[model samples]
Target: MRRLLAICVGIFTATVAWAGMPNVTFPSIDGGTLDMADWSGRPVLVVNTASRCAFTDQYEALQDLYDTYRDAGLVVLAVPSNDFRQELGSAEEVREFCEMTYGIDMPMTDITAVTGAKAHPLYRHVKSETGFVPRWNFNKILFAPDGSVVDTWGSKTTPMSRPLRDAIEAALSGD
Candidate 1:
């Protein structure tokens, strides 16, 4: 009976996780908080970024994507993480670097942990629900307007990649 109960609880947890996104907030690089709930009616593309990674150049593509689809309710959220040991020394530095180097205008978070026990609540929830973790910098997680996980891409997947764009298109169109 105890074993059965455990299995049932696990099922319930997974079901709840699949139903919606975790109520998580990020430490906005601009100060204060960036609540995920605020983007409820928009598709969000979350990318874990590192300033010094080889994939860092993808920031330009990410900005272009935001510029192109933002009017259609697409939100590109840049999460600066030093989990892979490549981010700048501080949030101020990260912000300055991103704005000056990449011309980024999208939302961004401070240098937060994106792996292990110290990972942000959103990352933890995603890992627990989908077993998806950022293996390296620039890992992307696409979320539907309803807050469900749409798809994910690894470090090499550019923001303008066909597959990722298709997923975003679907999410925006409510597919």
Candidate 2:
């Protein structure tokens, strides 16, 4: 009985430590705090974005996807990052440009770190779990409804890709 109790306790502690997804806190482009914990119970697409990158046009498609599926448990977050010397502006400027040009209504977070030694906690978790970083702007990380890492897509993968759609469907259906 003593051995069984100890084993159960160990399992419980490990589970608690590893349960759900890793937590992250970033700032909104407007200087407000953005907490990943608030996204609990929702599947999210975390994308590293830049204003001047070649793939910056993906923002339109991403916004389209978000508009299409957001009512169905999809939450797309655009995180502007200058990690690659791409976005060379302040958060407010990036937010204004994206909103004015693309009409992006999804969550627009501050310029979070996405690579090298200063990667944000979310990006660190993504790179460690998925074995890849945002090689360039517009890399996407899809979180499962249960907050686990579901898939990571490179810049080449369009927001409308079938695999992304299918993965999101699977995550939603599982909920």
Number of the predicted model whose TM-score against the real structure is largest: 1
**Candidate 1 residue-wise lDDT, 100-161, digit = tens:** 99899999998899999999888888898799999999999999877778888999899999
Reference-based lDDT, each prediction: 0.90, 0.83
Counting clashing residue pairs in each candidate, in order, gives: 0, 0
List runs of model 2 lying over 4 Å from the truth: 1-23
For candidate 2, write residues 1-175 as lDDT tens digits.
9999999987755443321434367888877787777776678899999999999999999999998888888889999999878895798889889989999989988888889889987777767776878888999989876668888888999999999989888877784
Worst 10 residues of 2 by lDDT: 14-23
Candidate 2, residue 131: Cα displacement in angstroms equals 1.5
Cα lDDT for residue 25, candidate 2 = 70
Of the candidates shown, which would achieve the greatest lDDT relative to the real structure? 1
**TM-score (all chains, Cα) for each model:** 0.88, 0.85
